[model samples]
Target: MPISRFPFFSSKRRSSEAFSLLRRFGPSKRIQSCNYGKSSRNGNGKPESNPLVNVDIQAPRSWGTYVIPGALLGFVGLAAIFHYNDERRAIPKGQGNKSSGNFVKGPIIGGPFTLIDTENQTITERNLRGKWVLLYFGYTSSPDVGPEQVQVMAKAIDKLEAKHTIKVLPVFVTIDPQRDTPSQLRAYLKEFDPRITGLTGPVSAVRQMAQEHRIYFKKVEEEGDDYLVESSHNMYLLNPNMEIVRCFGVEYNEDELADAVLKELKRTQN
Candidate 1:
């Protein structure tokens, strides 16, 4: 048939035909085998020369660069809010304190108190209604601060009475009641304005009254005959309802006190 059925072909002729086939296709088969071996050794069955296999890796970015500035900004915002609130609390309630004409609600001050006046007449908080009251706490033995404060009150009262029909009762309460009896207070008050009223009572009653009005007072012991009353210099302006309208510090002078009283009167009228 073709090549006489092959079983009868000579051995030398078979060898020669196999050699010719190898020369034509042996290189392609050997290359495929080598590629398969390389893929198995790399573990993913991918070629070593693949571009995706040797990709360059980069490090992850840190969060501190963004986080620190955000925290600082938050802290600054909180401080600004607190400062705004503190400034608002410092604003006064009536006119003459500022020209803006804005009224801020002040703190609620003053409380109930009962004591005896210069005439030995019992005076309670209720008796002081329907009239504005200027209240101060001091002793007759005060060296310098007490007299100056009383003068300020007297001048303010004279100015108010001369200008307006308002009735203001300037009341002085003694912190040292041990030596300030009714007669003693009357004589001490005579040195100041005639419109001023002096009040004194038992030690317990005076202490209670001072506590109610937030007046700080303490007895200072001296080695010799010298004695002093350590206390805060405070003056309170009370409305007709016996409620504290404003508190004047030691910094205010006679003119400033008068101006503040006038502004308060005008504010009440409005």
Candidate 2:
């Protein structure tokens, strides 16, 4: 009789020399023994050994079957974490990320609309798909905000032309289209820069464009002049795809505007 740590299972070490001589190796490891000392053969022609009796090599079956697979899964999880971190770090700061591309390359913060240009052609959001457009939305009568920003945009385009082969079209979108008609816009633009093209269309279209660029404008009641209308003055830099890239405050400096244009040019070149 051999002792077993398992309560339900026991091992019978056959000490009979005749049985031991019939055994293949070591002591006879009786898988199960009948009280009458008989042996049974299974359908495979092998002895029906006891469940508790065998070489008992402790083959690390549990570790091989469960722990190794679990370890592999853990390794894959860790690798995924590392891969995500590496990709996140590779993105340039303030640029469009993998999620989507904005006009200026960050989170989108603008509106949408449709309008026409100087050519009397209908220009929708789709038309802006191929060229970088510097959209200037302001009133002609805006004493300081209107001309100053247009000039800054003109200079920025000039700098971009001098430094790179980028062709940026300056689009002057007038908020006071009621006062600044096509001829009025054309003349007003000449006073600042000849290259600046004035775009005037239907009032509805102008309003739509303003809404798209996140512009605020309203007609102010002036007691003396019926031709006067006040509007929110702002500049929108749009990408080749007619999307608002970035917006400039009424007080943005020329150098800052130039830098922004140049940065966009770099992104475009890339």
Candidate 3:
């Protein structure tokens, strides 16, 4: 009966009363209403239809919910960019650095070592002289990353040989000497590129060669005699004098590798 307890107002009430009623509700329910109708004789003096009264509205989303996650994602992106840049900073070549842990501006790579080719021919680092070599160290039995890197090496050299005057020799030296014999190396490499000269030798020789190249590899047994070799996925670009020019990692795709190698060749030629 009282105006304070009974919130509804009677006819001829001031809008100030309605303002007081709206102030009682929290911010979320503060949708404005508009009443437009012909002047009527209704007992309550309210419009017959308040079209804007039931309008659907919502509160603005909190900045914390979206901003925190967005900031975290931005930070992660920056960290990744910095880490990638670090990998590239060790050696300067073309527009981007060669991707790998082993690098130029450091100790010597591409030392003299003896290895037998797929045909059992003695192929030493001396044999690689007077040749531009794109060399990778991996095992034939590698299931995933090894095949991809070898394929990249095969395709990149083929691309360079197509138009470019630079003749690059693609070489694969196996880490799994116990399994990757001359015959196995021949079969595995031929599938990707027949020109890829595969090399395999005794375990001690292979280990010594890997150390010379700063390549890390270890055999983890799976079941019985089956195992996997965890090794550095590095590819070395050697100049004609058998010196390491640049180091490529698993990061490079075929096209990128070809383009990078071409630029290095031109730089050296000039």
Candidate 4:
């Protein structure tokens, strides 16, 4: 064939070349991109090393996954803190109230009964109504435990009345009722406080009262065919309603006893 006059490509040939280049590197072709020289996954499920092209990648965000659980945990923690505070606030500030139910409130078997006091005045359950009573049960021959407890009661009563302007009737009931006649009890009580009252009755009656209170006692035999009674030394604090409010040791400190009695008084008043 003879040589053509024009050496440059024809328009159709130029258009074909342009089309081929676009097919190799056009917007429709898959592009790979990465950041900071770290490879990222591309849409083709392959690691990409290029940095200039746009890529679809995701990072963990806190809002959608963690926000709700964190909020719930915070709410639970705050509720527990508030509940503990409320329980601490509910503790008794003074003498506490008796538990409601099968528990006895006063001397278990106390009822209308006559007993000679320190001054030989007749006292009965009815006479004690509407007055706070501190009842002590023990024998005159009791070791230091009994007598010392009575002294504590006297002092505690005095302290409470002095500070809080409250009066408490302290009564000593004999556990060895058979041997502790009215006269013997009266004489023994004088060693404590003149305000301390003494009570004596038949053994059966005394046992009734002790049983009602669930107090334990027994008569131990001695050499003289006589017996010494070992019994509970509980000092019971009673409300004006004749209900047992607190049972404390005879040796309770004045502050502790006074606080307990005062708390009960507040409860009854309410």
Candidate 5:
């Protein structure tokens, strides 16, 4: 324990030297340089490198961004408009005439034809003048659908006569004249309303009449002696002059048929 003469050997001097060495070897210089660069880069409040840190980057937009969305919107708008038009066209003209404007005009649907009545007398379209005619094409041998439709037609005609003093002759023309002769027609018609008139003739004449009205019918042979008439279920409302006014499908009921007939009657009168 000798007392040191050099100041470097003193306790205070030794502590100051240790502090300088630590500062030289520590992260002070690196921290100072980083702060200086950051402040310089941010002097204009703008970034030198990428502004977003640890964030994904994307390229600039092209024309497809706008075009694609616009095209999709246009397609959707067109589809919606077409669907609206279809719905409008589905409505019948008897309900309203608003959508009737889009209906395409076609050829006249009825013409003159000579047929044999149930009384075995030859009848022509000319004989039914000045009378509204409800014409239906079906066979007497029709099992279910034809009979049901004929019943509906008879009921409608009766209702129309009772309500408006309007008389409509309901005519049943057979598509199967081979099986439904004049006597058979008379017997079959008696089962329904008496106002219904049954008519049957040669197969060629029946087929020509069906063609004029755009009706379809064919005979399908089943088991021995069992035959079926495959035909469309169509009913026609003809004016006094033998021109078709309106056509009905299988879905029409008695009330609907009568209402349609009345509307047409009023329209023709005006």
Candidate 6:
């Protein structure tokens, strides 16, 4: 009975060894933990080498994608701020600003000036104190925009004078005193309107006046005796008190100029 039991135990031990060998050599690892190094199995039963092809790296994405547009928006905001400041700086100091051809009340601008009129008489702001003045600073040699502006100004004055209530003195001051003598100024102004008072004086006096009124003028392209003078060419509307009320640029036509002056006149009347 003991020998028979030994045979049975030997057979059982061989069966256990056989099972262990099958675990070591057979496809038992397929049921165990996965091998992440080689993720997939090919048709030949070999593991695929490219882990990236099987792994979902696109999931759990980073939050850094919005940085560029946000940075660009910030840069654009800063640029706009700089541009606005530049525009503000470009406007004259005391004159707040104008909008779409509308005038705003600003600091009083002007100073006393001594200049000779076309009539060869010494003229000052005192002489024109009782009447409203439409004053302009320009040069006869202004090639492009000057004559047009003068024409518009003359037409505006004509229309204003035609109206019964308000009478305005139209004065043209030469930025180029060297070339615009009394005779030359008289003749030039008569072509526009005989009522247009043309003024010319010593360069120093003109310079001082221009500086006080914040006028900018420069001489360019000089040839022996003839040169071109460029100026702001601003037309100023002055009250009877000789204080500047508004400044007009070259943008206005005769009708527009007449309308603006009438508007100002009506405002003062009220």
Best by lDDT: 3
Q: Which residue ranges in model 1 land beyond 4 Å of their true spot?
A: 1-107
lDDT of 2 at 100: 29
Q: Tell me the tens digit of each residue's lDDT in model 2 across 35-70.
A: 212245466745555522233222334557888899
Model 3 lDDT per residue over 122-146, tens place: 9888788899999889999999999
Task: Single out the weakest 10-residue window by summed lDDT for candidate 2.
Answer: 91-100
Query: Candidate 5, residue 214: CA error in Å?
Result: 0.8
lDDT of 4 by residue, 1-270 (tens): 234423323534554565456546555535443332213447764556454554333443659578899899999999999998655533222223333212244444344556666566777788899989998888898867777788888888988889889999998988887778878887888887778888888777777776665567788888997677777677777777787767775446667777777877787789
- Residue 74, model 5: Cα distance from true site in angstroms: 37
Candidate 4: worst-modelled 10 consecutive residues by lDDT: 93-102
Backbone clashes per model, in order? 0, 1, 0, 7, 0, 0
Candidate 6 residue runs with Cα over 4 Å from true position:
1-107, 163-165
Of 1 and 3, the candidate ahead on TM-score is 3
Residue pairs of candidate 6 with colliding backbone atoms: none
Measured by C-alpha RMSD in angstroms, how accurate is candidate 6?
14.2
User: How good is model 2 by TM-score?
Assistant: 0.55
Alpha-carbon RMSD, each predicted model:
16.2, 12.5, 14.8, 15.8, 16.1, 14.2
- For model 3, the stretches where C-alpha displacement exceeds 4 angstroms are 1-107
Which scores greater on TM-score, model 3 or model 5? 3
Ranking the candidates on TM-score from highest down gives: 3, 6, 5, 1, 4, 2
lDDT per residue for candidate 1 within 183-269, as digits (tens), equals 988888888887898988889889998876667888898889778998886788888888777777676788778788788878889
C-alpha positional error of residue 11 in candidate 4 after TM-score superposition, expressed in Å:
99
lDDT of 1: 0.74
Candidate lDDT values, in order: 0.74, 0.63, 0.79, 0.70, 0.76, 0.75
Candidate 5: tens digits of C-alpha lDDT, residues 1-270: 355445424644655565455555544222221211233256684545533222222444789999999999999999999998765534232222222211212225656799999999999998887889998999988999899989999999989989888899999999999999999988888898977888889988998998877788878999999999988867877777777777776777898788878887887799
Better of 4 and 5 by lDDT: 5
TM-score comparison, 2 vs 6, better candidate? 6
TM-score against native, each model: 0.61, 0.55, 0.62, 0.57, 0.61, 0.62
